[model samples]
Target chain A: MLITGIKSRPVYDRLAPMASGLRHLAIAQGSGGQPMLRLLADMTPAQRGVATVVYSSESFTGNSYEAELRAVDGIDLRLCASNVEALQVLDDLLSTAKMGTRLYLAGSEGFIGTAMQRATEYGLDRDEILREHAGSFVRRVWCAHCNAYTENVTQRIFRCPGCGLDLVVRDHYSSRLAAFQGVKADGEVPGELPEIEELDT
Target chain B: MTPTAEPTAFTTDETYTPEGAYTFRNSREGVRRLPFPFPDDEYMYSMNLEPHVPAGDGAMRAAFDIDEHYISECHHRAQMLEAMPGVHYLALPHMMEAQWDLLELIFESYARDYPEHFTLTKTGNEWHWQNRLLGIDDTFTFGDPTTLPLEPMEYATRQAQGEFVVLEERDNDLVIGAGMTTQRADYSLRFNLGMRFFEFHGPVPKLHEMGILDRALKFLLRMKPGHPVRRVNWSLTVNPRLETSVETLPEWAPDRATVDAENAGERVYLRIELQPLHRLPRSNAIVFPVRTYLVSLAELVEHAPDWAKRIHRALASLDPELVDYKGFHRYHAAAVAWLAQHDDGAPLATGYPWAEGGIQPGD
Candidate 1:
């Protein structure tokens, strides 16, 4: 709402080997699935044996790397209809995961964030988890006034379906909320709205 | 902030004595490992600022760190609160939103720091909190107190290493709006709740005259949504109990001030409190988390002879006003002599532990 292409959001890591990891879990969604396949190909045979893949079919552009992911041998792959379901599987996996387990994340900012939220639930430090951002830059926003989550938001300003108020999407992002902030567009001067522009997705 | 660098596990030495299931590891590394509040041997009140845990790790940084003694400390806190039911936890009904804010923040922090042990999830207005460390995973409507086994503040405080107080700012001044502080060094929370900033810290020596509290309040008010500022406060404690606050001052204060030479090292001890003050992002109230630790005077000397000498010098030069305020005037002479006597003829005050190649006495 206040700024554009602020690159102030979290910077992601490229697919690679992480340090001191006894076990590894690679998670992705839709187009993000491609990176998981590449990451698996980079692992040693023994490392591949211990690695697990959690994938979600959800996609903004209808992209899917399912066939390629399934073709990869040795590593285990679990499929889901949505990112939310993938997150559930990740949570269960982390509950039994130990100190030396490493996590790799690739997907939409929203999907990666949702998965990372699960990682945080298991207390994975920065050294223990690496994220590779993929898919669209389209943000998922939470209406500041009504607390309603709007998915796949591509614009800088839009009316919130929850409260019917035109909301200006803020540059800020909350990993805790797993969404961008959407505040009233014309709070200072009622009846006046900010111009609806396309976000730099 | 506690060192985010992963710590090596404790290993016992030859001279170690087992005390109440707590093994005494005679390592200077162990003593230096503790978060000592003083940067210099000479001490004075000032707005000491260090960057609070950076961003995400910062979020996980607790108002109190969970260390090896966490379970016993939690038990001690529970006992303290149970004994003094009136002073343990307090909040005005108007502070409901802030209480919920604090509880949610606690859940978020625990989930981040102990991901293997805790999980917090939200669906609609329903928030589900699972804490393996605390052994309960409950689902409840957000902000509804009746759904939990304990009050939100009490529940959060029980698992914490120390105490937490929330200060609500109004009229450009903060008030002791709510808290679950069962381990106050020497202060009365019951009498201080709702007190303005100036009055709340009135007992702190030289704070007003030196403008430490005023500057600290300004620094605290300037805290942004994500950045948190922290500092360390320290003193001498005569006991190991977590409940050695103002109410129990008489029980131990007399001994701290009047200890004889033979009892000096065994009786008096250093007490350090790692305190972080930051504004809560949602409630806009300030949260003060104090994690307190204690190491005995004799054990400290055994750990590092340089520290013993430095502490002796610091105590000798301590201001008269602060001495009486800290009740150190009671046994400063014996205390200083005991610390110096432990130096064993080494050249005193070469430098700080790190500057002097990390404390050479026990190496």
Candidate 2:
């Protein structure tokens, strides 16, 4: 009912060179390659030399800058087939990563959220990270009943793949779960559903 | 709206007896001690913070309050946890220290404030606690979770009144790391846990643009131990129901449709949350305790007419966005229509924390 104005969504930052950072780790997915390419072009030769870039080819919109990202020089690029594999790579990298490393994330909201969750687990400060939202705003929703997550949701109401209940996605977002809340749509009065509409996102 | 044909003065003789498990009976002392949220004729969002000290003779005397409803409220909380399973409580692994800090704070405060009901004695790492009011006696290692039936935060909050959320300070923000919240108005601990201060408060209207959240976060981050602060936030509920979490929305939301102008006075309740924030000494975290109090419109107009009028003005003029945000949109009109009978359009004094009589600094 009160889903019109939501401020819980994170305001993304553009990927830019942090002059003081001795090392950089840029992670992106699908359409996010454009920003990653631009960031590499903006970086000085010294900054690019010590940077490691990770990009996943998986995308919702089917837009990719994999060729342009690969042509960039001096930076080490690691490409993954999917977002899940890319996050796994990030977890392994951060486990052995040290201080003075700055993280840059550009991709879908789901990718950024998963990336930030890893960054938090690694004790990365907000100052050491930059996230730019790219691609579609298709939400990653967490079902309240089954504690399950459904990715790339574009509708206000949809059926939860986990519990099979019709779920209404609330405007409320949680960075911890890296998703919006999806509760049983007809929990109040079973079989009486609210009007269906596309999400403003 | 017409001028009052009823008495303007309040009477202490009336006793509001509980009609059900969720309903409360406010005695004369209870009515006076209530931290009524409306300090003016109208309402708007503000910092509204104050020291956690006593506001008046009958006002709250300590951080944790144990009233006549303590036993019943605790019983209600237990029932909720049993029904919901693991949905109502959450704590991250990194919040262990904060959990112990909260447990200690609750025990020490309860013992100090209400010595006749609670006591805590410590010898080395082992501690002995007795809660005569709830009939509990336990001795265990303070920091060990295996020593207790539940986690430290859950055990302490189960024995204590109200909902408690432990906010861990990290990365220049407070995160909802742990909570025992069975009595929330329309929020969920499972969804809110691990969210930054502003992230969880994102649904609130207008305050973000005014930079209130930014300013409030900076202020809270700098809060030191022993200098706690308190504020009173309010909303209207359909009944005196306490288990209003989003997890159980289906169970309670239907009550909203049952309200109308005629039954609004007896069915609607002004739900007040007495939130006190304390910076824990060891964990360097903030323990947020929300103590809820409910007074039906009928109870207020019958015993405390001044409060009834003030609440009427506040609700009648509330912003539509706020009415919706408070989850009272369906019955907002009906509640306002009923309250209009009490509001005579009389002018209230400009100061805040108005009692049955006049304004005080208590707000």
Candidate 3:
């Protein structure tokens, strides 16, 4: 069984024992980008042999995470730049899996929901996949006045809760794509396929 | 209250150790003695906060006030003792009870004088109030007076058993190393705070080699500074019966030939060392600030596989209240909610060591 979104320790502690019956484990995390890697680093020598893979969405370049990964004895790490890349990696891993494979999804509600949808599309058994979504990630806006990022789901407004900075969520996906395709921000942009990288394959 | 006039001709007892441990003496009847040996050593002392009492006061009131001040002074003495070298003070339950009484008096006085300035709640024998002056709740609890000695070794063991453990100890008065470990993936690297035990006297060499004594001393020194009344000297060593082991990564060596040639048994034993500092004073204070690393039983179970079942069983075997899922969840949630509401400038600390440099979601 593969578990994603494992941010809590209690959940990992509980799952680790039950995981003995399983062969392959894949941990997917969005924030901090290295939950599985951190777990593996702290694991005893006997525990590290359990074929485990970590898929992180956060950027790991030029960070201690790379050094941490090198320090860990036996674990595979896959860094996905965007949700599309993450889905591609998840699809490839699920495609070659047997019918009884279990996938555990953890993290923000939206991220888990997105993974569940992708898993279903990839023909993974619904019963085999467990979803443990704790909280929703409201759009966080950087407040200039308070010098803190604040998000309020109830208000549905982008204002700093700390210092009341009028903020707007900047859409990075389209802008980054435009820059990648050599299209000026003000120019008429050509429709292009969403860039997808198969990480596991 | 204009500093209630100091009673004239207040007969002060010179025997009252400035460390705040004291023996009560009635002027008319001579010294009132207890059955137990009075701890009059330099490490312990007693003081009388109220030097004089009106001659006509009722016996119950006099006893109650005396009890109150004795308890309060014990805390004061403990704080002072923390400043002395090689001396650490843990409060007994009676002392804590007295401190609570004093707090109650202070709260009552505040409510009576400035009713508009605070909110007060009386539930059974306990009174709850908020310091409107600071816009914060008066959440201090003198629930018990018995102060137990903080044991770091026991704490380390518990932490090794997957329980969250934070150790904030100073190193030779130069560096402060605060370690926080939680069962949470994100908080594994942060320093943790938990109940710990340390033997006062043991093989000093073993203790020094284990580094436990140094950590404990640093922890104590950070909590309490040396003062005139209190003096502390601490020496520690690990129990000889406790076997120690070590781990080394030869794979990360400079060359693969050297790494492959290296024997697996070439690991060095982790020798911890200890030393006694004369000026070190012992203190029992929660040095680590409470941050946002609380997890619910349900969340723990979901994230940590079988952690809920194991912790539930363990806590149930020790204290049944810990197994009450709803109660535990409520307590955990309340702590997180409290943290979210309070805007203390300290960053939200996590136990996950790997999340140190990453841009966290809530950041």
C-alpha DockQ for predicted model 3: 0.01
**Docking category of candidate 2:** medium
Q: Residue B305 CA error for candidate 1 (Å)? A: 3.9
Q: How well is each residue in B197-253 modelled by candidate 3, as lDDT tens digits?
A: 231112122343456555655444544322111111111111110111000001111
Query: In candidate 1, residue A131 scores what lDDT?
Result: 89
CAPRI tier for the interface of model 1: incorrect
* Best-fitting candidate, scored by DockQ: 2
lDDT of 1 at A137: 90
Proportion of the native interface contacts kept in model 3: 0.00
Put down candidate 3 lDDT per residue, A1-201, tens digits, no spaces.
001111111121212222422434454555323454544555566556654554555431222244555566665556565545766787777777664455655544334545665675666654465444332343223322233533222222233456443332222111101100011111111222123222110
Give the number of the best model, judged by lDDT: 2
The residue-by-residue lDDT of candidate 1 on A1-201, one tens digit each, is 134333225568897867578899889998888788888888888898999899999899799998888899898889899888999999999999987899999988988877876786677876788888888898988775566889889998888999897777766565655677676666534565678788876
Which has the better TM-score: candidate 2, or candidate 3? Answer: 2
Model 1 accuracy (lDDT, Cα): 0.70
DockQ for each numbered candidate: 0.01, 0.50, 0.01
